[model samples]
Target: MKTVVITGGAGFLGSHLCDLFIKKGHRVICLDNFLTGKKSNVAALERDRHFVLVEQDVSRPFRVAGSVHLILHFASPASPVDYYRYPLETMRVGSMGTHHALELARAKKAVFLMASTSEIYGDPLVHPQTEEYWGNVNPIGPRSVYDETKRFSEALTMAYRRAYLLDTKIVRIFNTYGPRMRIDDGRAIPNFIAQALKNKPLTIYGNGMQTRSFCYVSDLVEGIYRLSRSRYHDPVNLGNPREMTLKELIVFIRTMTNSKSKIVYKPLPKDDPKQRQPDISRARVLLKWQPRVAVEEGLPTTIAWFRDRI
Candidate 1:
């Protein structure tokens, strides 16, 4: 079995990956500083023989003993709330953290995978953003901390691949949601679900016309796994192509939750993308992957998790 190391392994997506790899009989070392990641997320695997949880910040230089066949760099404050609250930390992880991860991969001659985001496309000028379209990002904006850092991470990964010939891959993740999502993470799915469950008004920012494509966590994870095994080194977009406006999502959640939550309006956040969608033609052709879980099917599962937690 291969030995895999996942940075940020105690976080939402990272914890799930740890479970997946361990289930497949691979030894997994999960590294996290817990700035945003919760120990409870990986609590179930504490006794597993193949799982090793390491509390270390990737931004700082760290080393591992023995052979490491794979390294997945997922260390970063992913949510808007988290990054906005810790902008400098976000920048450091995206840069120094990524650097350390790359060095580890190079040393072990392992496959390096970076978990990038669709935010790199930043208020995209192109509709249904494809992997080829360069993004339109405002460097001085509030959201740049997350967006630009991801962009830099991708660039740095590519540079390592070219200079050191280190096997590297980057997957640009779109809006993804599922169980273990913190209620106050400040993403749309959890925010709407929490507000609706609490019988509070669902807040819609800026007329709620801004569009986003949501991919269930399982679907996204499958796609990332496929990309990791494939030879294609260029960035791949992994997300459901179904697009919807914020207003529509709120209505759907209210109806699904059977709540009396009224809609409220707020000024839109600066640099928030007006339209967000992924053109996953490449993923479909290359990875032989497409999102199987529709929002209708996925919502209930997510709601049940939140219901139990809340």
Candidate 2:
């Protein structure tokens, strides 16, 4: 069986990935500092002999024992609230943490995968962002901590692939929501869901006309798994192409939860993307993948999970 090392393995996306690898009959070594990641996310896996959870800050150099077939660098503060609170830590993980992860992959001769985000296409000038888009990001904005660091990580990954001939792949993930997302994640999906569940006002920034494409976490992880197994060395967009607005999202959530949460308008956050969508043509042709779960199919499951937690 293949041995996989996943940094940030206790976080939302990382924990899901850890479960996927284990279910596929692989040995998984999960490393996380729990800075923003909670131990409870992976608590269920503690009993499995094949799953190893290590408390580690990957921004600092670390070593792993034995052979590793794949290294998935997913360690970083993902949400705006988390990054704004821990900017230095976020930058360190994307820079130094990524460097360490790449070095480990090089030493182990393992295929490396960097978990990138569509935020690299900040306030995207392109309607449906493709890998070719250079993006329109503010280098010194509040969101720069998360956006630029990911851009840097992608560059570093490509450098390793070019200079050291490392087998590396990058996936530019779009908006993804599913179980295990923190209640105060500070993202649209989690924020709206939490508010609606509590019968509180659902706040919308700006006019709520800003658009985003949501991909179910299961579909996103499935695409990621396919990319990890492939030989592609460039960034591929992996998200649903279907687009929706924040207002519409709130309406749907309110209906699903049968709540009376009123819509409240707020000023838009600076540098927030006006439109967000993915051009997944590359993923379709290369990975032979497309999101199977529609918003209708995915949202109910997510809402139900939140209901239980609340």
Alpha-carbon lDDT, every model: 0.94, 0.95
Model 2 segments more than 4 A misplaced: none
TM-score of each: 0.99, 0.99
lDDT of 2 by residue, 1-310 (tens): 9999999999999999999999999999999999988999999999999999999999999999999999999999999999999999999999999999999999999999999999999998888998999999999999999999999999999999999999999999999999999988798999999999999999999999999999999999899999999988989999999999988899999999999999999999999999999999999999999999999999999999999999
Q: Which window of 10 residues has the lowest lDDT sum in candidate 2?
A: 181-190
The regions of model 1 sitting more than 4 angstroms off are none
Name every residue pair that clashes in candidate 1: none
